[model samples]
Structures are given as C-alpha cells and as structure tokens.
Target: MKDAAFGALLAIQFLTRLPVPLACPWTPATRRWAARAYPLVGLLVGTLVAIAGSLLQGLLPPPLLALALLSLWVALTGGLHLDGLMDLADALGSNTPLERRWAIMKDAQVGSFAVLALVFHLAWKGALLWALLAAGASPWWLVPVIVLGRLGAVGLLVAVPAARGEGLAHAWQQSLTRRDLVLAAVIPLALSAWVPGGAWLALGLAAFIIVYGLAVRRAFGGINGDIVGAAIEGGELWLLLIAWSWWSFAMA
Candidate 1:
C-alpha cells in the first residue's frame, strides 16, 4: 500500500508540473512500478483541465478560451510533451546519421524545424479544442484523450526497443513487463468507453499507438525519451482530431 502511494507520487512528479511533497528513494525497481501509475497521472491532468474548461465554457469567446486552456495545459505539464515533440521533429527533419540525430535532440537550443513544428502543433490543438467546445462537446472528452496519450507512451516504452542504451525511455524499457503492457492497454480502453462515441476514439488511439511504435522503430532505429514524448503529443492530437470530426458528423 505504501509503495503504491509513493509510486503515485513518482508518476505525478515525472509527468506533471505539480509540486509533490513526497520524498521517496529512487531505484530501478521504483521507477518500474511508477510507470504503472502513468495512466492515473493522465487522469489527474485531464480532470483538472476538464474542470477548468467547463468553468470557462461560456465566459469567454471560443478562441480566447482555447488559448487560455492551451496555456494552462502547457503550464500544468511544464511543456514536457511539447518539448519532446519539438525535439523529435528536429531530429526527424535533420537528414543526418542516427547518432547525429540523437545529438540534435539533446541540444537545448530550438531549431527552425522545432519552431515550425511547435507552431503547427499548438495551432492545431488550439483550433481543435475550440471547435469541439464551440460545437458543444463535453469538456470531459479530455479525460479519455489525455489517458490515451499517456497509454501511447506506455505502449511504446514496453513494446519498442530503446534507441540507445540510456535515458528515461531506456530505463523504462528495461523494466516494463508483459503484464505492465496489458494493464496499460486495458485501463485506457476501458476509460475511453465512458465518453460519447468513444469506441471510435479508442480505435483511433489504438491505431496511433501501432503506427507510432512502428514509425519510431523505423525512423530513429528505436524509441527514446523524445520519441515517447512525441507519441504522447501525437496521440493526443490524433484523438482530438478523430473525436472532433466524429462529433461534427454527429451534429451535422
């Protein structure tokens, strides 16, 4: 019980900007267990964001509300996934050898590719959120979307070979088991079912996970922390796109 409590703290610490006051010893064993709690962390993030979205629903214009929500979303996660998405874009856009691509991702400075990718990603996400909210989709849709995103990360961490023999991805890769994979997949699918027209959302997320894992394997030789991060961001966008489109069709 105590271990589970600490694992939850580790998950929150690793996944969000929230200041968790629990101090626990770090070990490979601990990290592996903490990985199991990733979906719960996504739930917390989504719930908070959904609550905020609900509160701001009619208080501001859709564009302004979306921008505010987007800012809050980034602030909550400390832009961790966004940074990963940018790093992955920079590495993929660079027509260099694998080692050099890895180095590019490690560099702190943002490149033109990263900048372009970030702009497009943020713009698309903001527009999608705005459209969905304006169309009267429930704000709680975020819960499934965010959970699916984290599950994507967990799926890759368990299934894909590590790009290199180091970093957070590699560490999780070393520790992930078959049971971990099953639990990760099952929880997200089950949670997704609670939303309207969620079966399609689940299908989209599953497809994204499969495609993303394979693409990461082909593109960068295997998955890394950046790629895992990219998977989360990419999965979220895919879910939102699919969900928004479905909602639009139903409304029409």
Candidate 2:
C-alpha cells in the first residue's frame, strides 16, 4: 500500500510538475504502478485549480477568472495534453497515409493545423469555463468534472491498445492489471460522491469513457499517449461544455 501510494504521488509529480516534500525511490514495479496511478493526478490538479479560481472570484471577472484557471491547468500539466492535441490535429489534417501520419507526429515542428487546433481547443475551453461561471455554476462542480475527466482518460489507457511501438504509453502499457482497473473505477466513483450533483457528473464520465473507447477503436486503431492526452482534454472540454449548456438553458 505504501508503494502504491508513493507510486500514485510520483505519477502526480510527473504529470503536474508539482514539487513534493518527499521522493519515492524509482523501480520498475513502482514505475509500472505510476502509469496506473496517472489519472489520480487530476484530483490534485483539480483541487489546486478550484482553490485558485475560487480565490480569484472576487477580484476577476468571470472570463478573466476562467482564463486564469485554464492557464493554471495547462501550466500545471506542462501542456502535455495540449501537445498531444496539436500532434493529433496535425496528423489528422495531413493528406498522407496512416504510416506517414505517424511519422508526422514524430516531427517536432508544429504545423498550421496543429496551431489552429490548439487555438480552437483552448478558446473553446476558456469560453465554456467563462460561460459556466457566468451561469453561476458552483465551484464544487469543477472539482468533480476535473477528477472524472482524468479518470475517464485513464479508462482509455486501460481499454485500448497502444498505437505506437514507443513512448510513455508503450513503456507502461503492460502495467495495467484487472485490480488496477477496479481500483481506478472505485476511486472516481467514491470521489464523485462528495460533489454536489455528482451523480450526473459520474454519469457523464461513464458516457465520455464509453464514447472515447469507441472512437479510439474506430479512429486511431488503438490508443497511444496522444490519444490518452486527447481523451483527457476532450473529456474535460465535453464536460465543461455540457455543464455550461445546461446552466445556460436553466437560466433561460
């Protein structure tokens, strides 16, 4: 249990670039468990982001607060998913075949399509978050959304096969076990229970994971680190969009 907890915290540190007071000794087994614990990192990220946004509530307008929250989120994660989003966008936009698309993703240069996609994705998220805040969605809602989004992404890691021969996804691809999946499922469910309207949030998470699973099967042939990142960003955006829409309609 200590190893598992440390592994989880290590994963959080890796994903969020957050400093920890203590460091876990790295081992192959611990590294494997770290991959399994990656999703839980979002719980920590969400808590910090919520605290920041809530604190800024009185000082900043809704749009500015949303931007600040979004910026903090990207900074916390070191823009990992944003890079994936860009790479995926560039690959999909190319006229080349699947083999070439994979090659394109390997290139370090960001293409026009990638730039456009990043802009749209970030803009959409910022606008949605602002709209949610303006609609008077409670800060409590953000917590579950963030936590569930990451868990939903983790579900993808377990459910799909890696699309590439190498990368972080490939490195720990074999780490996932039946017990790991069970633990992942349980953690999010338990955490969701703490939030207001959490049942709906959990339902949305289930739906997102289900849909992403199907999409991964059809689109990417399987999952890679890129797809996992895409799932996390996409899930968060989808949840925020739904929440904003609901709030807007309710206000109407």
lDDT per model, in order? 0.85, 0.78
**Predicted structure 1, TM vs. truth:** 0.96
Best by lDDT: 1
lDDT of 1 at 1: 65
Model 2, residue 218: displacement in angstroms? 2.8
lDDT of 2 by residue, 52-151 (tens): 9878887998988989999998999898888888888898899678788888877899999999999999999999888889888765567767777777
Q: Tens-digit lDDT track for model 1 on 1-252?
A: 666677778888988999998797566666766787888888889999899989988888888988888888889899998999999999889989988998999999899999999999999999999998888887888888888888778878887889789888887777778787676667777787767788898889878888888887888889888888878888998989998998999766
C-alpha displacement of 89 in model 1, angstroms?
Answer: 1.0
Q: TM per model?
A: 0.96, 0.89
Off by over 4 Å in 1: none
